[model samples]
Target: MSTPTSTTAWVHKTTIKPTEKFIETLQKQDLPLPTLGPKDVLVRLHAASFNYRDILIPRDQYPFPVNWPLVPMSDGAGEIVAVGPQVKSFAAGDNVMTVFNQEHQAGRHSIVSATSGLGGALHGVLREYAVFPEYGVMKSPKGWTHEQAATLPCAAVTAWNALKDIKAGQSVLVQGTGGVSLFALQFAKAMGAFVVATTSSKAKEEQVKALGADVVINYNETPKWGEVAKKASPRGEGIDVVVEIGGTATLQESFRAVRMEGTIAIIGYRAGPTKDGEKEPGWGEILGSICQMRAIFVGSRAIAEEMVSAIEVAGLKPVVDPKTWTFDEAPQALDWFEQGRHVGKVVIKI
Candidate 1:
């Protein structure tokens, strides 16, 4: 392919209203191509997926600060249209997906890697072309669509980190039907573990069951569904790992569900649909639960590659929401996702 000098992009812009309130929006524009470094590659993005953080960054509502007026959307897949001289892992026409964190090539998470995330610390892939260091991307799974590969970077990688060290016959508990939870259910089952899933919708409960969940509980009908999950585990000991995403609202119940000294992977902050909001329990309650709670901010590039290999081996398919949007409809798609209208990932085809 000929080298391109310009590309179409959707920039995340934050404007201050006269009332001192902030408005978040995506502005479409023809932008100059990214500057290529000796070890960088230029990707022509085909598809990208949305994450909850994408909704917060533009609004300046994300807890972590971000660069404004940047090309947004971290999870993306495409072909390498060009590469710098030192780029070796990939070449022109190679299919690849963006790494969630540019500096996190392998091993454990660190302060540098944690903050070097694409779309947050670096320019992301919501454009016709983008550039990244050679370590910032990897080849997509064989025969996977750009949309399908796009869904893995954030939600799937986070789920994979949450279930690290999972052994066969272990008990894993997932909350709700969000992207991370559903992926956790599928991954845990693939690892030969028993999965206990919780959801408010009867429709979603059936879907979760079909994903090979050993037990499915309705949190609305059973507010204390955590105890139920505990009892449903092997030998009724409790969950070995809890993919905790509900934040303060669901923390208490998660404590109840995890086994003694089990791991609670704090993944997301979406609250449950409840009147007057849910209560956040005190540390005493957490101490009583005796569970280990730690935040896993997605995963490194090495982790992502490992996940793709496992996915190919298991033939696992990610669940993308049926309702999708065109590239021009990005802002509208974010709004729909913010309103919690979809059960799985809401993607945009570029």
Candidate 2:
């Protein structure tokens, strides 16, 4: 394969605060490719996936400051079209996916790794062609399509990251039907854990149970869902892992659901922001539970490779929403995602 002259990419010049719409802020233009660094690989992207944070960036609601006029997406899959002289692991025509935190190769998350996140601190992956450090890309799963592999970089990896140390016969609790929650449920079941899930929709409860949820609690109907999840846990013990996505609104229930010394991997704040006079509830509830809470940023590149190997061996498939958008429909796709109707990862084909 030969290198392309230019790539088509979407850049958000400013936040939606000005235009209050994505079509106005997001612009697609063809531009000349950058000179590939010695360790870089030039790739022709095939697909990209959406996450909660991606929508927040354009709304100026993300926690981090996005560099203006930046390409904006965290997860992507493609095939290498050209490799720089020093590139070794990948060459022309290798299928691969982009890493979410490009600079964080291994070990644990640090200030630097957290700061180097793609789609936020750095230029992101939603483009026709992109150049990444050799370390920033990893091989796609053996038999998966570009679209399937595309969903892994953000939601899949973050779920896997949060699900570490899950063991057979243990119990895991996943909340709602979002991308991360769905992945966590599947992985937890694959790990031989009894999976308990919470969702408001009656239809989603059945769908989640079909996805191997041992028990599905309707959070709206069952206001004390954590207690219900606790009762449903394997051997009737408390949940070993609670993938806590809701921030303030759900913490008390999570405290009720978790076992002593268990982990609550804090992933998202879906319940929205705290009010001016509203005080965040104290941790007084979980004191007896003695649970540990860890904030899960998406993992390092090493973790991505590890996850890909696991998926290949276990044949774990990511759940992508059926309504796929073409490259030109990115703006509309974002609108659809912001509406919160999809059950699985929303993907756009490049």
Candidate 3:
């Protein structure tokens, strides 16, 4: 394959206020492709998926400072077009997906590996072509589309990590109907765990049930939905695991819903953006609940590989939103995601 001199990329030039349009801060420009390193492979990205964190970056809501003119988005899959001298794991024409953190290969995660994430500390794969270290990309699952594979790195991996230890007959409670939550529902059911899902919209209840949720709680109607979830557990003991995405605003409920010695994986902060001059809610009853609460970043490359194998074995297909978008329609896709109407992962085909 011939290497191209330049490629198109969407660059976030500046941070914007919450009320402002995110697309206003972005500019598409033709950039000269960087020289490949000894262990680098150039990928022609075919598709990319959006995450909640991607929206937060341009709004200055993310913890990290803006890497100006940054290419945004961490999850993508494509075909490799070129490989450098020492690249042996992959070759030209292989389909591959990006790992969220380039340095997190296996075992425990640390500050170093955490800082090596794409789309924030490093350049992301929101462009037509991207250069990645040989270890930074993994072969996509067999018989999956690039768009489907693009959804795996962040949301799917986070769900996999959260439920990896779950056993048959255990109970899992998931909040909302976002990418991670839906993935959690699918994985929990595949693992033979009874799944209890919560959503604010009554209209989405059926969709949740179709995804294998044993019970669906409308948090809107039942404000204390956590207690309801606990009571719904077998023998009314409480949920074995809670996929808690709402931080300060919803942790109290998670504490209420989780049983003694249950596990709560704090994966996201959909309920954050705390009010001005107000600290996050105190630990309150969390300590008394006697549950294990851990924060979940996206998992390692090894975990992703393991997840792919499991997905292949089970023939699990990720539930992507029906609405498809062209690469130029990224702004529209972001707007659709921010509105919070989509029931599953959103994708943009390049």
Candidate 4:
């Protein structure tokens, strides 16, 4: 491993408190390198991706509770430089990635203990170097880049967890052109499931179709895009699974598109109210609309491992866009992400 640098990262200060509006400036730090414990491994982060939850948590709309002045990202990928004495699963040359639940390393949700996520409660990987417990990291598949591996932990695993039991030839409905939604499209297609993806712009209709979506609906052209989604399938049967990302603006339509006894994974709310003055809908109304199969947050590490295996077996490739900034340009990257024009994942190279 190379010598640890004194100027390893750019840290962001608490722009907004826990219950305030969004703030976008990052405060740089000249602090010493982080020290590792006996059971820890230090990772030099190469790239980190943005999630809708990352954008909303700082804005104080997300339900996941967290502290201020925290590094705000849940997904990252990097290489291990140093390992504690007790560590045996990895070495200095190993390329590993972090998981969403630090304690839930490799099992179902019930088997794992509840620990705070990296970018959730504790300091996150927006920094250049982060120290993680040996259990929280996993070995990346051979030949995958740090950026591709970094995109998997949260959004990719969530899609895998939602569709793990789905049989081949089943149908899934993915909403919009976001990170999680795109992962749902790719993974569902790899699983041999018929996919129907939605977009507000007709120009993107061919984009989703190119990604193996059997049907594409322009929500802007047809306010009831769900009706169009239903007609795309055989016998007018509704979709067997719906990856519901639109919280209030399109939740009822998701309900209308789902088949009886089908599943809907409520991963995120990317297109809801942004400002404080706008009127927000009620939860009862939202839940009342999604009167379908069980709804879940994300999957466990076991599910994540299953996803990795599937991706490797099927040669699945993550739909990553491009890096617009480096570690020093974090504030700009976050600002660009808030605008919501990018198609795939927006990453920061550290």
Backbone clashes under 3 angstroms, per model: 0, 0, 0, 0
Full-model lDDT for every candidate: 0.85, 0.86, 0.89, 0.76
What would the per-residue lDDT of candidate 3 be over residues 205-324, giving only the tens digit for each residue? 988998899999998898678789999998688899999898777777788889999999999898775556545436667677888988899899999999999999999999899987
lDDT tens per residue, model 4, 70-186: 777878899898998999888987888788877665554543344467676667788778788888888876689998888888888888887877778888999888888888899
After best superposition, candidate 4 residue 295: deviation in angstroms? 3.4
| Number of the predicted model whose lDDT against the real structure is largest | 3
| Clashes by residue pair, model 1 | none
* Pick by lDDT: 2 or 4, better one: 2
lDDT of 2 by residue, 1-350 (tens): 45687889988876777446676667898777888999999989999999999888888778865687778998999999889999989989899998898878999877778888778888887899988899888999998999999999888888999987888998899999999999999888888988889998899888898899988889889977878888888766689999998887787788889988999999998767654655554757667788899898888888888888888888889888889999998988887888889988999999
Number of the candidate with higher lDDT, 1 or 2: 2
Model 4 ranges with Cα > 4 A deviation: 1-7, 15-24, 31-34, 106-115, 273-293
User: What lDDT is reached at residue 7 by model 2?
Assistant: 89
- Tell me model 3's lDDT, rounded to 2 decimals: 0.89
Off by over 4 Å in 3: 273-284
Q: Which has the higher lDDT value, candidate number 3 or candidate number 4?
A: 3
Task: Identify the superior model by lDDT, candidate 1 or candidate 3.
Answer: 3
Question: TM-score of each candidate?
Answer: 0.94, 0.95, 0.96, 0.89
User: In terms of TM-score, how similar is model 2 to the real structure?
Assistant: 0.95
Candidate 1 runs further than 4 Å off: 15-24, 272-278
